[model samples]
Target: MHAIDVNELYHILYTKLGPRHWWPARSTEELLCGMILIQNTNYKNVDRSLANLDAATNFGLAALLALPDGQLQALIRPSGFYKNKARYLRAVLQAYHDHYHELAALPTPSLRKRLRDLPGVGNETADVMLLYVFMRPAFVADSYSRRLFARLGQDAPYPQLQAHIAPTMRLNIAQAQEFHALLDDYGKLGPDVFGLADQYQLKL
Candidate 1:
């Protein structure tokens, strides 16, 4: 079987799906807060929670930080896991506020490490923040990416898969962001879209 060409796959997906309009947030603070609120929840719930937060405090990091614990939890209740999520969101926002200026000056690797050090920020979440929020050339090898590549006969864990694919594409920030969005949206289309079930199969 031939190796899956990451560039080719990216192009194919992009051609079919166009732009994904992903990471639907207006500001870095909103995106960061979303990075926490979105955990273990669906997009709709996250959207609703973001809307609730916006209505209450205009979705500013400072605003969220100023909210009382109960108020914060209540606003994000729609996203589920309200108790833990509120704590994590508060911690992340506080950290971001503390280092807001310093963060913009850090390199991509350093920024990713710093974000990872924050509460509830994992590799995938950090990558999402890097690509969408910070506009870094980070590839998010999330579950959708894994499933999509696995179907095309390239199955590896997060780090390996990320390393394998990131360099191959050599994408700029905009392209990298779109690739992730397109891949995830395509993954949600099941095994039939683009005849992927057969077309992308390994030639065993």
Candidate 2:
């Protein structure tokens, strides 16, 4: 798809969905924690897990760091992949505790690299943390984003797609975060807003 068309799609989606208020978190640390827990999981489940923790404890970095692994696993069970996700979370938290000593002191690039280096944290997860928590300019590409782009006839693979789009968007960190939130909201609300499936016919 042409860059103009991509931008048009973004505009249409944004107009339809408005602001998504995504990556819902009570604090920066919670946002980062949610990003790690949310891999391979739905937002609803992640919310449930976060609420579970919030209701029972302080839900701060210190509390999370002090919590036993088994307890953390149990609290986040709703997000699924509890055991592996818990291990990944612990590794990330430990890295923060050891190096930064406080979440605010963690440099964005350094924290992002460290997160990407940890097991179970990939580009998407790392970018989520960077964008939502660190307020960095990082675009996230996932399955729904790929499907949307493919439908619009862009042929790049996921990684290349991100690289191709990020520069073209010309958005700063805050704008990138808003752009991603808008795209995700579109995927969730597309059928209802477009009504294209029933209005048009496709050979494929």
Instruction: Quote each prediction's TM-score.
Output: 0.90, 0.80
Output the TM-score of candidate 1: 0.90
Off by over 4 Å in 2: 1-9, 100-112, 190-204
Q: Write the residue-wise lDDT of candidate 2 on 71-149 in tens digits.
A: 9899999999999988888787676666654544677657667768878789888777677766677777776666666
Candidate 1 has an lDDT of 0.82
lDDT of 1 by residue, 85-185 (tens): 99888888887788767887899888999998887888898888788777888889998888878878878899888777766666788888899988888
Best by TM-score: 1
